[model samples]
Target: MQWITIFKKEILEDWRNYKWIWVPLVFIVICIMDPISTYYLPQILESVGGMPEGTVLEPPEVVPSQAIMMSLTELSMLGVLVIVAISMSVIAGERKSGVAELILVKPVSYFTYISAKWAEKLLLVFTSYLIGMLASWYYVDLLFGQITAGQFFSLFFFYLIWLIFVISLTIFYNTIVKVPGLVLTLTVVTIMAMSAINQIFSYRMPWFPNSISGHITKMLMENSVPNALWGAVSITIILSVGLLIASNFILKTKEMAD
Candidate 1:
């Protein structure tokens, strides 16, 4: 019951602060841009009006999978920053402002409080992903090619796991470091480093959780996912669970800086 109350409070914060509005709008725009740009490259180039006379422009055919890939890539690049910005203040802001101190003096357990925050943020991420996915599929089919249900679900679930891992990491980092700016910087740097290391050791450590993007690209290209993805998924799930538990523990020791 207390957890639910705290979760609702988190949701209310999202609503009042307009985080729910702008975040999903950004995602929807990214989704729409993916297919629109792919299908209209020739026209877009012509509109630039710098082409030599009689230059033939043959636009490349864009596939549905390609649009999906572009959408997911945009999310990976831009969405992480957006999500981190919104989540950076979850605990740090409260602690810094003495809100955590006031609230902690009540009957609230730190575990329930942190769990509620994590759960609510997870739900928000899932909602945004759904909207982005549906919008991408609708436009991709209209502008590029038909996306079958099988293609959509296979890649979506696989990509979703990676996204969940990222959100968990953001929260875990938020709890560990109270400075919002440092939290954002460290989280982005860590994820980028993980991706690079995963690539450098691709053949050697195919089962590592950071190889998620490679698997996502392969699935988007309509290829059979390598058996290594299963291993990565397992590792990612364990890590995400550990992050939440660690966050819960860390939150208990926080003293309000204000």
Candidate 2:
């Protein structure tokens, strides 16, 4: 019940801060741009006419699935930065501003406090992403080709787990680090390190969370998903939950010290 109360408060704060507006707007622009640009690329190149007079430029046929995937890939970079920027401050900023102290001194458990924050952020990010994906899908279907509902849902489910991992990692650092800048740096470094490690050891460890992107691509381009993907999904879920628990534990420890 307290979580619901805090969740509502968080949502109101986000709206007042313009996060609800700008975050989703950014995602929509990022996603839809991919499909629209890809669709008009050939015509735009022809209009330029800078190529050799004798050369005819032939753009490869772009498929709907590939176009959608490309948009998702772009999100993993720019959109993820947006996520990090917004989430880095969820705990650290609150703690620095005395907001956390004000709230925690009340009847709220630290776990309840963290849960409410986590749930609110999760809803915001996931809703923004879903809206973006749907917008991109509309263009991809109109310009490229029709994408099956099954394919759309599959991609959605896989990417959701990946996002869970990302948000959890950022929130974990936010709880432990007092400075938002340091939390951002640490979160980015940890993500990059994990991604690099997954790249290096993908053969031996297909269950890494970073491997989810590859699995998504495989499912799209190859029309099949590896059985080992379930292992990756399970591990990702476990790690996400572990990180949230760790965040709550660390926050409690820090509170007791203070």
Q: lDDT (0-100) at residue 55 of candidate 2?
A: 71
The model with the greatest lDDT is 2
Point out where model 1 deviates above 4 Å.
Answer: 222-224
| Model 2, span 126-237: residue lDDT tens | 9899999999988889988998888898898888898888889999998998789988999889988998999899999999998987888888877777776778999999
Candidate 2 residues lying further than 4 Å off, grouped into runs, are: 256-258
Q: In model 1, which residue pairs have backbone atoms overlapping below 3 Å?
A: none
Clashing pairs for predicted structure model 2, backbone only: none
> Who wins the TM-score comparison?
2
Worst 10 residues of 1 by lDDT: 249-258
lDDT for model 2, please.
0.87
